[model samples]
Target: MSEELGMVIGRGFDTWKRNIGIAFPFVLDMLFSGIFFLLVAGVVALVIGIDVFLSFTEGAGAVFGSMEAGENPQIVEIFGLVELIRPYIGLLLVAFFIVVVGWIIIR
Candidate 1:
């Protein structure tokens, strides 16, 4: 039993070692996917302004307070989002356009 197990393990190890090169494309895919994500995010942030994220952080406390007071947090969040985004609809549209173009080019 012990000898048989050792042979099985050895064969499995050999098979894995021989096939290790096949994993390179997956690694490269992940690398490029991450790079692509960062590139897109940076472009969107540049277009839409980084203040959008900061505004969410700054307003979270008010949302949480409203939630604790028995208000629908989702509605509060939605309204708050609308308020923040209303002024930037044009910029957001531009960001969306750029991202779509970038995605088409990358893909």
Candidate 2:
């Protein structure tokens, strides 16, 4: 195991000596994506001027009633652009609540 580890380390050094450049656009893309999402989400959260629960509930009620009526709801369309996002949002909210509760218990 020790000999194998040494050989692997030696190979790593040799490989680094040959091709020092590597494709790294994925890291840059992830960084920019995170920044953009945070920026846009912060602005939207601020402009809405209430906690996430209020907006989520209002949006959810509108979407649920619209779905039940078999008519396209403006609420779902405006925020999600797709009907499925509501359930995902609900699931995420539930998961977050669970985490918060767990944290409270541990603390």
RMSD of each: 10.2, 14.6
Q: Estimate each model's TM-score.
A: 0.38, 0.29
Weakest lDDT window of 10 consecutive positions for candidate 1: 47-56
> For residues 28-98, could you state the per-residue lDDT of candidate 1 as single tens digits?
89999999999998996776566777776667767777789999889998887777667678977987999
Candidate 2 residue 15 C-alpha distance from true site, Å: 10
**Model 1 spans > 4 angstroms off:** 1-49, 98-107
Task: Please give, for residues 29-90, the per-residue lDDT of candidate 2 as tens digits.
Answer: 88999999999989976864555566566767776776788766665556543543554577
Query: Which window of 10 residues has the lowest lDDT sum in candidate 2?
Result: 79-88
lDDT of 1: 0.81
- Report every candidate's CA lDDT: 0.81, 0.71
